[model samples]
Target: MDKDASGPKVVVGVDGSESSYAALRWAVRYAGLVGGTVDAVSVWELPGRYGWSAPAVDMDVDEEEARRRMRQELTDVLGTDAAESVRTHVVHGNPADVLLRAAEGAEVLVVGSRGRGGFARVLLGSVGQHVAQHAGCPVVIVRSGPS
Candidate 1:
């Protein structure tokens, strides 16, 4: 683990969804206030039910592309410096597991209540619920509502 004397490290789970973006924004603001850095993470999971017969898509889509897109989206919402403060990470695994692992040394873990799911009515997505339950550090679930 990389220890920093500067300030605590804030980890935020981002998936290019509106809710995740909101969480990322919140994390950046909180990190700025606390004199910390933000680690923006995006986890890509392979469909488990597909079995071995499922044709493989381009699962290894460029990490830089993902980071670039995330940065662009965040920049649109919070400005260039907000995007720059974020260090991007792209990992392959279950979102919840990946996020929990990343949150190990973080001062705070931030996630969105609901993400880009097909089911619109789902109050909380699986990843959000899992992180809320299992993250080692403090977790902040950003919901789409008045703060």
Candidate 2:
């Protein structure tokens, strides 16, 4: 959160939910105010049942395809100008861990209050809670925008 740095580096977690999109927007606006870049991180993983159900069967997961989809979503939300100050990454791991790593030297980490998790009845997603509690930098939780 220094002012003399080469531009603030903001890290944001995204999962294609309305809340995540709002977090992305809020991060970008904050970036503009702080004169910084944003790293949009999207995470995906194999279904929980994949490993337990069948260890012999090889599940085909296209990581590149997931990355492509993330890039598209970043573009769709941030528009073409995303290339200028926004970098999107599709990682295969725990969302909270990935975001915490990405925000290593970042000024702050942003996330939605909720994501596309199975526990939709909950107020906050587990990933957000993890990051908010354990991140090295500040954490901003943005709720979904107006519908």
Candidate 3:
């Protein structure tokens, strides 16, 4: 992915979770504050339980659905005007790996305190915890408001 020509880049991971939406909003606001651009990324991975003998699946459809969800989530969180300016990506890979890769050379990597796969009792999601420790740039973990 290309860095924004106008300013620094802010990369944020988005899943279809309230926490992720909060993170997206935070990323956009922070990008505005820093005169940076936002790259809103949604990553999906095939079920690893299937291992080498996984059933055939339509990869294109999966990716497109991810893109659609990302767009819908962005509009839901940031509204059309703000969402339109942010660049979006739908990637197929491990969530943390993809996000960390996307964050390379970025001003900061933003992610939710937790994503869909983690236990609610935990303070941070597995992917968020991983990226916070491994990201090349600074990482911002935006916690969701009280339920």
Candidate 4:
């Protein structure tokens, strides 16, 4: 059992992907091992352009949807009891930027090898690569196991 409610913080980025689910599970187990709390973060932003031009976007709607999805993903991946133990955050910004900022002073930042986007041929996704290079704390990039 975790003795310290105020122990080290483990920050994890979840994007509802298989690799991300794997990362989430890993973060929970690691947090348990170290008696730390988990901070599960998800980020969403309107696309820069909609093919030719920018489309009208509703910030309120987008943020709310992001928050809802994050919560559902947490429950789907970690279940109710386990998910409740981790603090959840839904931010509006670039994935890498948000995750790095969230990881500030954290024990470690955990992310999947790839998120929703990117070519499978590539080893690491853009956000994972960026955070691995720029995060102030240690970063762990987990790849999903065989399905």
**Candidate of highest TM-score:** 3
- Give the deviation of candidate 3 from the true structure as CA RMSD: 2.5
What are the TM-scores, per candidate, against the unseen true structure? 0.84, 0.84, 0.89, 0.86
lDDT for each of the candidates?
0.81, 0.83, 0.86, 0.86
Better of 1 and 2 by lDDT: 2
Point out where model 1 deviates above 4 Å.
1-5, 49-60
Clashes of each: 0, 0, 0, 0
lDDT digits (tens) for residues 1-147 of candidate 2: 122337878988989898999999999999999988888888876656334464444478788888788877877887878544677777877678888898888899999999987886778888899999999999999999566
Tens-digit per-residue lDDT, 1-147, candidate 4: 122449899999998889999999999999999999998888777765234267656555567777777887888888999988988888777888889888987899999999888587777999999999999999999999976
By TM-score, how accurate is candidate 1? 0.84
Q: Model 2 scores what on Cα lDDT?
A: 0.83
Could you tell me the lDDT of residue 121 within candidate 1?
81
Q: What is the lDDT of residue 12 in candidate 4?
A: 92
TM-score of 3: 0.89
- Residue-wise lDDT of candidate 1 within 56-131, one digit each (tens)? 5555467778767877877886788768777778887778888889888889999998888897788888888888
